[model samples]
Target: MCWINKIESIFNSTRCSEEDKVRFAVFMLKSNALYWWNVESVAQPNVLQTMSWEEFVIRFKTQFYPRTAVRQMEEDFLKMEQGNRSVRDYTEKFIEYSQFVEHYVSSESRKVKRYILGLKPSIREFVIAMDPATFSLAVNVVEVTERNKNRQGEEKVVEKRKWEGSSANFRSSASFRRPKFIKSDNYSSKQPPARTCPRCQQVQQETVNPNRKDVTDAERQVIYQGISLYLKGVFNAIHLIIFGRTTHN
Candidate 1:
């Protein structure tokens, strides 16, 4: 009976199906002892040489198997997000298996991520309303909200004003501070009349219109409006194009 069992074992080992072989390969990788010498590559050279039929099967569920699976998962995730591929249409397929992938980006895979962008009010309200988190998850979420209160406020204000209208307020900060690069004394000139204005030749019109002496207050208003609209349109067009290119890229 012992002799027969040994013969049967040898026969079964050689006759293992390809699925069993691959599964065995996965198992062998999981054993750090099995991979003691070589791990730079995913392949299991030691398994081919020393593993018995049963030991290989045991190794498949050990620590190293997931790493191999993750590598394969990463390749699949990259192909899904290229330009021609619509993110919504194909992203679902990748998302279902993304957790299996190795080293996928936090924003992409989302298993372990530092929240760079805080959730919007609408999203937060929805998450809180829906299946409330398990106790631990709830506590962590509250902690995150507390820590990011200032950042969240900034994000909300930015979103609220980004496109409703142009944000015209200048940000005055230390970034705007100048140390008087070329110092000038605060003194006034006493003399004038190097060149007389071609139109307003009598009164001092150094900063005013030289070619329109008879221009009335109403005409000035019209000119200012036209110039303001033209400048606004130009600046708006330039900023719009810059934003569009940056977003698309």
Candidate 2:
């Protein structure tokens, strides 16, 4: 019917002659037919020939828009369900299907009830609990519910990601604080302190005065002993800082 009205408006507004208008209208209708039955009906030359544009439209409606067809559309509307679609999409489908039975569900209350009944169970309870008496109110409630549900889901995801991120950070910090074990060729529970030569220490200090002779092998050994003592002190400091444990002498 809408298609017929649109085509009629176009021809009526144009300068096309009555004959041209009827021909164009029939051509458009024939070209738009979907099934083989429709195609065969439109292909019949005598079907709508010699009729005015207005008479052709009347005949077209009489042939296609039967009362039984409207009843079938109403039955299809009753069987419609939201299924797994989003609330918004389901609402659109509900409105689209209701057009067929718009005359039957004339009152706001009936439209509201019919629309809500087809909604998914997840949102249907809350929508009904609001006790919406009109179709607009029911639609508003469903839209709000969908928005709030989406927001809460997003919040939960964000919270979970934050918790996981914090846990990773804590583990990273703990790893930095963890002690490192030092392995040696002769690993022992305790390490021995370096031995220093007091005589060579005094000799080296005296030799720096420039009044002493060249250092002897025994004095040089003392110098090496002093170097080992200094290195051992450094190793102990490092072990305490990194491993939080002291090397026992």
Candidate 3:
């Protein structure tokens, strides 16, 4: 079928005569195709001389592209849908399949309708609403619609990622800026609290007498011992009052 189309394309471009078109196409045949053509020519010697390009195409398709295959191609074309294919890919397939089922897409309106029906629903709705009169216009509309839908999906994904990123950043920043209060077991270790002796109410004041210069060294030592004992008793009283225990003497 591709070879047939290529031959027709060359014929159309070069404006070749019918005889030249058939000859050139037969000349290009190779391997199995060449063998089949040789056998067909021997069976019908005058076929090439009498056959036009159109007649040659008919005979070639009858031999290689069987009726059953053509029918299956037509069925496939009728059942075609966009499925997971991109709009461009779907369009290319539609064009290829439509060639075998020309009766279905004989008119521009029918061709456009068939093409639109085969598109994915998301794109089909917009293309139908646009009501394109030409097959090309319909294809263009569907392509644009598909692109827009894809772009919107990508944008939604981007927005969701951005939102998640911002939420993560906000949580991190909040954790960083928030103050944490830690509880310590040794609260009084750094600076001891001031406590006064309950019995004294005031600290004891020690005085030195100038007249002590005439006193003996042993008498002065006895006075110092008495003051030290009194101060020790005062501390023990303070400790007992605060801690429920007396300091050892």
Best by lDDT: 3
Give the higher-lDDT candidate: 2 or 3.
3
Residue 151's lDDT within candidate 1 is 77
Q: Mind giving the per-residue lDDT tens digits that candidate 2 earns over 12-56?
A: 788678877766775675443435335545777564456677777
The count of residue-pair clashes in candidate 1 stands at 2
Clashing pairs in 3: none
Please say which candidate is ahead in lDDT: 1 or 3. Answer: 3
**How well does candidate 3 score on lDDT at residue 30?**
95
| Model 1 ranges with Cα > 4 A deviation | 1-69, 102-249
lDDT of 2 at 143: 91
Off by over 4 Å in 2: 1-62, 66-72, 175-249
Per-residue lDDT of model 1, residues 1-249, tens digit only: 122234346558788564455444434343564454255234655555555645543343244446577567666665543233332333344445444442454443243121111234433443364433243353356345544665788898988897444433333455556766542232123222356767978666343342465555555566688778999999999999999899999
Which sections of candidate 3 miss by over 4 Å?
175-249
**lDDT value, residue 3 of candidate 2:** 71
Query: By the TM-score metric, which is better: model 2 or model 3?
Result: 3
